[model samples]
Target: MSMLPSARLLIVDDEEDMLRLLKRSLTADLNCEIEAVPDAVSALTLLESSRFDVALADVRMPGMDGMEFLERTKTAHPELTVVMMTAYGSIDLAVQAIKQGAYDFITKPFEHDKLVHLLGKAFERTRLIHENLLLQKRVREQESFQEMVGTSPKIRKIFETIKIISNTDVTVLITGESGTGKDLAARAIHRLSQRDQGPFVAVNCPNLPENILESELFGYKKGAFTHAAQDRRGLFREAEGGTIYLDEIGDISPTLQTKLLRVLQDKEIRPLGQTKSVKVDVRIIASTNRDLAAKIQDQTFREDLFYRLNVLSLQMPSLRERPEDIPLLIQHFLEKYSKEFGKPLKRASDEVIQIFLSHPWRGNVRELENLVSRAVLMSPGEVIREEDLDWPIRETEECLVPAEVSFLPYKEAKAQVLEKFNREYVSRVLMRNNNNVTKAAKECGLERQALQQVMRRYAIRNKELLSNEDAE
Candidate 1:
């Protein structure tokens, strides 16, 4: 007989004897990867890191019972095949469990062969689900960026610009408020451009230190600086014959601004400490969430370079301005993140969708994606519900601090609530700035390093905050 492949399983029960019995039976009957947890809390912690094909949970236990556990698992991890174990064998309980999305029920002292049969059926079901998800992904790959999931006139117009200008090597400038999908627009342009086959290099301008940005942009020869141990090619060299996306163009200091202007004008670059300038043939696509015209008035950004980069301009509409796209985006993320997290979630409830529609998506498409990612990870039932979503609470401006600040102590319940807003606000700023702490700091009126500290404190993953310059 052909042996079955190893399948991961989570056995949740308070009875150590029962847990041991289940492990022994499953291991003996089939090749399995098993983790026996005492309760739902432990099971959830394990689920956070591991993907199990099936979770066999007891119906009754202290703290979170099996029924409750089943509800939570189905919500957050709909892809997981769940089976309930109960000693009482009550029909009402079994019916309730089935309603809550339990695969089936196994009464206490069940036959060993029956346990193996149930697992075999669950494994086959999981295999089919995985195969279907993979097929859907392949179908989506041809035209999905997770950014092009809208049908609004504003977004359609942006696509028109991409199609018209992508074939040329003209310097295209994309402008939008922070959270608008500028990065997506840039990538879309490149994907459809003649240079699609070329490398799509993305550089968040302000992320690199000003002192080193020059070398990062332009190649540096050996001995260019104290620690220039070897010759190094710059981003331009890396993007040669392709397109280099210069993000947060407004954040680049005036010094490097001049060098960048020369690169655009002369189509050549001089390596630091090298006499000869190398001729480079590359297309430039630059994006900025900042207002270059206003910066030009303030003299923080170069006017000549602004005109050079704006040879072909595309402006992305913000999420609030295009409410019609919200549903499409939510639906897209429901499928996108479902496949991404290995959890096939059901469509969001109307209440949840309404919340998404009514709320001002200040963070834009990227924010919506984050919200969905969180909801998918935390929802307890097969479908995402309102409580699973963490809505940003409204803060009062009357008190420079939270209105409850005086009544609360540091790290208290209300104080932690305040931190939540700060976390989200800082996250939006960073996403808007393309994770460039310098630019985000300048915009948020905090120091570059200070903004970074805030990100670290809230565990706001800079990389996880995805934004598309004007796509927000």
Candidate 2:
């Protein structure tokens, strides 16, 4: 029941005296701005000129009565709240006005207090509408950059971090598993940077051989190689004054690593079969699914190159880490593919949602997008069902039988049920993770030591779960 002091109200009636009384009383009681007009025509003219929160009109007015005014007002400004005023005999007309789109009706000679209460509720509705519109505007602004959608604290923190670092011209190393949106994050940084007007070039490192990748990164001079028919500018040169995202940087060969290190140290690249180095101005943003630290220890990747790339590191969280965002992501993809495919699909079924929440998203966001896209395209009904989804349900997910059941005591039955659940759940988690205890422990929301204790209780040995090659 909060009153808006700034709420604007419009009152229309042919009776000057009635309009005067209403304008005076309502203005004082509601503490809101009031505009009174003699006829419905004048009121419509005033409405066309100014915005109003609520309108009070007489149902018996001549030459365009309140009912017509209500209809026209609703058609023009659907958000506007209107209440009809009528004489005692015209209560029927007021009821018809309600059917046409009147907020509510008040008879003539009504108590001023009743009108004030009704108008207060109407004003609150207007306020709520305004607030909801503002909220939706903000959500659209937040999601305008890319498909990186999430309200979880981790994702919000990443958003904040990206904004803070966007203005700075520093190397950013985004490390995460494949399909974790590392490329999207790189594009977001480039879009927000001052050099946003320039081109953003992406290079998939593992996609090409070392010799070709080197020539592609640092363009070769004409006649530099077999395809020397034309002079070409490499990806770095193409991204001048912008950003060049080197994806899967960990997979590049040692020779390429050394060349990349030199470029990082001095902002210059020596193109393949070229005698001189060329200076280039481009921001470097690299991402990798491989563990660069492990590669460094194994002497496969250069430590100096790793140090240069790891200047400002951003580790993307896997989809399973932020399960709260799964529903939002699903809805986003559903709407996207639905519109693209011209389908009338609305949402996924509850069973489908449950399956998504429980399943391990190893392929992360990309896997979810592919699954949702396929589901939306293939679903026969508007609602996406479990059967419509192509995701395989694990055999471990089958019903856990209380084998030691059949009229057993309540305590004994409960113990057996708990034991069965623990064993099956642990086995399922381990199987999914390739018998990797650390990963299984994390999926189970337990520390390695705690999971080991549970495993001992169930006599579950990890070695037995491993494949023959892995065990050997």
Candidate 3:
């Protein structure tokens, strides 16, 4: 374990001698900086000027009671750990203080060992809370930039494409299956672009009709339409000097496509029922889950517009193609939902992770996120078990291949089970080692080429399990 810095402590008591004794006892065992105060007011003043890792206050004070002091301190510094000290300890008071967010309380005449143990636990809790805050901040920052969480080669390629396209003003076409994070890629481009400080407006082409979409894209004048209450700005004008993300762009009608192409060509937009065109400076980032090329060939989509919007392109890989990233994604989601639900779920079982790896996530990361969130909420303990998740795992068809035998004897059954276990173990080891044949062989105590032969015989090619480019 990594060594953490010493905790700063504040001790408050009405009795000066008791305060000195408490401080001496604590400082003798702890390497932390300790401050002793005679009253709650002094402690509050000190807290205002400086930060402390933990605060200890006596329950009975002349001016302000320990419970009130603890409550006020918590209000000021929610992250600070506060413990109450009481000579007349009551179970009711302890329960009430805990409910009010006190870290823990100690009865008066406490043992030296008990004090040390409690303070140690409090210090560790403070350290963990600090670390969790830092990690959460980092996660939030990355999420704001729309960065995907994966180190696989396939994901790295996607990241590279985003990096290259973000510096340019060219139109981008993001193509992928549904729920494959097309909008996330668009946001990443916007965040990295020169207009990063400008507004990022997203409009779904499939959600609105052609007439409504035209007016929505280019603001209409007041009274232009029956429901037009007043003049309103469209998405393009709202995103002036920024970027406009059009999701599901393939669903746009052919007539609308022509008008869109005109806007791209002219760099201007004319609102509905308006004669004059409005000049706009906005970058276009369009995404679709369909094959626009096939649509253009079928005459449903225009080739000119396709060419216009296809200045740059990015493709998102499916979860099934990058199974190695599943564990990281699971960890990410677990942390997210555990904090969200106020439950600290530690880890998923190996069986649960194996099920995740084997299943083809048709809905991609979105599906995995939802499943993990539900599991975290439903789980009764710190660890998330396979039974806590509702993920579909078919035993007979999805995982197991049939054995060639009409009736299996005990010996045959035993052999089949052992063979299956060996194959599964070998496959897991190879995957965990990123398909490094030599490393996996050494780990499994087998010859390098012998492991390779077993993998081949089991139909578990390295390329099939992990992408060839990633394995390299």
Candidate 4:
């Protein structure tokens, strides 16, 4: 027997004769086990007692109707496949059933082959859905940390880094562009660390003034300052035997950096206007988008504090660097928002997905998630089509097909097009720099040799190309 034929089935109908007819129709062709129930209540009872591969129910039953029965069945046993059989089939009902999680529907007096074909597909989809759920559950349970979903090598490297640093108590410095989920990474480390149960206190250092920031971090005695009305415990005290995440650490003043360095070095905190220092054991996780090395060179950031926080550093890749992860991320966001909004969004259209992959997500995962949420709310139905998505045309244009093209032979045309682009790009860079290769290389994110190679290939060697006006 085929896999579909071997699947367990449960048939539900108000009439005993109809139940019998379904049993006979399926049992004759299927090489599997079958159960027949007279009403929705009995069908539900059977479902609770024993698992079935598929459930087929009549729409107009005596008690609970097919729609209600399907909803209850799906809620109770989401892994089971459900197909509704209705004499009165309309577009509204079909769409409603599908939205309520029905696998498929069959009309009354259905042909034998059509019934079999629909059932086969239902079983297959059910099997796949169940398998994916099992795998996802296994990953969640075994990994202990949330699955950082991406197959890109850059993301893989980040995973490796997380795994390596998770077991240690070293201060982790996560440097990434804003909205890159630095906070999530910090939590993942805590989850994988020995201090998993301890409190994780996050403080954004840049959002507060110097006095308030210090007071919030170190706490204050009653009347310590104008607004210090009572004795207060600081974040360092609250984070005892736990972790304290200092976000935007680079934005803190040099004076505060000195005070912070003392906390790292001595593992003690002195509350504002307090005479004594309180000893506290805490792991520090700091994140920033600024280049701390440059800040240190400029004397804006203290070198001593920089070294303390740099013990373990992780650089998060920009969204553009890992375009391959866009599809997975999009699906993740879609499912999340669909569930949140209580809507049944099946899938994003291929064109919409392609647009997402092609766009430069400067704001990273956060931006992508917002875009998906917006689209889900605006989408009229289950499917999210291309028109449902809103993309910035300028950002997409860089990665999408160019607007203008010249006709040429297949191979030669392509070469000529590439040459023209290279020449134009090189000329622009040279004009911007007045023909200075070093400055142009920095602007283009290319090495001097690489820029020269492009120049040579395009056959553009005008010394004037290096002149300031030409570069501009």
lDDT, candidate 2, equals 0.84
For each candidate in the order shown, give its overall lDDT on alpha carbons: 0.81, 0.84, 0.82, 0.81
If both were scored by lDDT, which would come out higher, candidate 3 or candidate 4?
3
Candidate 3, 1-472: lDDT as tens digits: 1214866999999998998898888886877889999999999999999978888878889989888888898899888888888775475787688889998898878888988888878877888989999998886554333557887789878888899999899999998866578999999999999999999999977656688998899889988989998887889999998999999888789988988999899999988768899999999999987788888889989999999999999988989888988998898889889999988656898888998999877567876887888888888888888888754443335335355532688788767866787787786566444456655664464655687677777767744554642553
Query: Could you give the C-alpha RMSD of every candidate to the true structure, in order shown?
Result: 14.5, 11.5, 14.7, 13.0
Per-model TM values vs. the true structure = 0.60, 0.64, 0.62, 0.63
Residue 32, candidate 2: how far off, in angstroms? 5.9
- The candidate, 2 or 4, that scores higher on lDDT is 2
Off by over 4 Å in 4: 1-75, 81-132, 135-147, 381-391, 396-472
lDDT of 2 by residue, 139-176 (tens): 86665345589888878778888887788999999988
Error of 2 at 2 (Å): 5.1
After superposition, candidate 1 runs with Cα above 4 Å error: 1-147, 393-472
Model 3 clashes, total count: 0
lDDT of 4 by residue, 1-472 (tens): 2355357999888888888787888876765688998888989999888979988887778879888999899899988989988785464686689889988888887898899888877778767877798899875454323546666788878877998998999898999876577888888888889998999999988667898999999998999889788999999999998899999898888889999999999999999889999998999999987888888899999999999999999998888888888887877788888999998955888888877787766567766777788889889978888777654423423522244544555787677677767876677556445467755664465656788788877777865654632543
Kindly list the per-residue Cα lDDT of model 1 for residues 29-80, writing each as its tens digit.
6687889999899999899899898888888899999888888899899999
Which one wins by TM-score: 2 or 4?
Answer: 2
